[model samples]
Target: MSETHTSPVVLDVWCELQCPDCHQALEDIRALRARYGDRLEIRLRHFPLEKHKHSYAAAQAAEEAAEQGKGWGYAEAVLARTADLASHGEKVLLEVARELGLDAEEIDTALIDGRHTLTVDADHAEGKAIGVTGTPTYVIGDERLDGGQGQEGLRERVEEIADRLLAQG
Candidate 1:
């Protein structure tokens, strides 16, 4: 009998773009992407901490980037420059949008119009409901790995969960 195809197992990664730890967690995300390829769907969920002044705007910008078909690219660029974001605020977000050849004006309008606020807010609310108190939290199936505690074995844990879920399919 032919095996039925199943949807890829989703790995929800709660992240704050201006978070240094989230930037560090990028390595693990890349590794997972490399390892699972299309078998795993790595989703970036916004969880802008209250401490990061520009995090909320950055999250909105990321949503706009997603609309422009450059979501991950924009996110990686912004995360790579967390320091700049901290120092320069929303300027860094616009800069990254322009650098990625995205519509900077549209992003600016989205920010001002608060178009993506609901999406970011919903993600934040859902994260809080799921016990996400920090950035880079990974949620696969019933497992929740907090990368803030230290990424020591976080990737492996996520891999184990993802592998098991894939096998169950």
Candidate 2:
């Protein structure tokens, strides 16, 4: 098969922080990134599920956190405590900000005021354009992986795609 595109042969993961499987998949990808370094550029996007009532809200909150240069940190906390959103409520999000060394009050204000709605909306639109229909869909170049596969499976696939990209170059 011919692997061709204007962009690099990168892996794009569209995930929801509320999904445990997505969290696991992201952990695996983080390890892979550490090992492979610049060979793979793993891009993360938001694909909050509709069933998770607080997911959109959380995504927006994370986006606001990003304004303070803590998006990934907030996302990590969200993924880590997927089960706590309901019981912990806004406290869970606040804890994430605190852990990331952010001003908790500022994050809370941003979340309450719905400051990052547009950023999250942009992520939603981008996810739709890329055919992201689930919490943890992956796009390997032009190929889409519907579910989170094992590390070996993902690595092998990435190697194949990287080989093709290298050949094209």
Candidate 3:
């Protein structure tokens, strides 16, 4: 993979902020990145479920945080505290953004104004177009690994694919 392609292998991760499965998958992805370094490129794509009332808002908050270079941190905070998102969703998101040194009021206003709705909607549409059925779906090479929640098999599976991609170079 190193010599085959000049770019890093893409790990298209379609996830939602309020999904527990997505949170677990994010942890797994962090571990993978730590182990592999820059050899892999993980792209976070929003796929908020319609069932989760605050999920779409959370996605916008994440993007708003991204503008301040805290996208991943905000996402981690939201995913970790998904329970509180029901009643105090926006408040919690702003708190998380502030905790990450981002401007809470800016993010809150973005959420109120729906600044990142198009980005989130486009990702959702793309995910649906590609037959995504749930959160934590991984699109790597020709393989699509879905339903990675609570499964011990994901790590080895991802390792196998990542190694093969790297070997191809």
Candidate 4:
């Protein structure tokens, strides 16, 4: 595991919100982030697959949540509500907003009026620049993992990279 000491390692995850693998990978990423804390910077970019019908809207909704100062919370809500979204996209998001105590009127306006397009587009472009071709893809420092892996695989990989970064210091 190679590491560059001059900069913090960036773990950029490129994934669509609707993907099951992406959802699971996020759980692992969250655990790793908690363990490593500020040793790594975790970035999440959207890579909505063509097959998933509601991913784009869902990504936009999360971006709207970011606008409301609840990006992370809204993200977790969306991930947790994936089944609900799969069945009822907008309805699920509204329910999530209510559950999280966000201003439903504002979220409804944002989502229905398409207010978060720029942010979502920027995320998409960034993912493209990093050569992310699939859901649950991760770029740890300069290295990339382009598909889902088991929890142990993810943990070991992240830890190995973290250790290398620390060593470089």
Per-residue lDDT of model 4, residues 40-111, tens digit only? 777767777778788888888777777778876787778776777888877787778888888777878887
What C-alpha RMSD separates each model from the true structure? 0.8, 4.8, 2.5, 4.2
Index of the highest-TM-score prediction: 1
Tens-digit per-residue lDDT, 3-116, candidate 3: 544568888888888888887776788898898878888888899998888999999999988888877778888888888887776688888887788899999899888889
lDDT of 2: 0.75
Each prediction's total of clashing residue pairs, residues at least 3 apart in sequence or on different chains, is 0, 0, 5, 0
lDDT of 2 at 132: 74
**lDDT, model 2, position 25:** 74
- Give the alpha carbon lDDT tens digit for every residue of 67-87 in model 2: 788876678778889899856
Cα lDDT of model 1 by residue, 8-94, tens digit = 999999999999999999999999999999999989899999999999999999999999999999999999999999999998999
User: RMSD in angstroms, candidate 4?
Assistant: 4.2
Task: Write out the backbone clash pairs for model 4.
Answer: none
Q: What does candidate 2 score on TM?
A: 0.80
Candidate 3 Cα deviation (angstroms), residue 86 = 2.5
- Clash number for candidate 4: 0
Q: Which ten residues in a row have the lowest lDDT in candidate 1?
A: 142-151
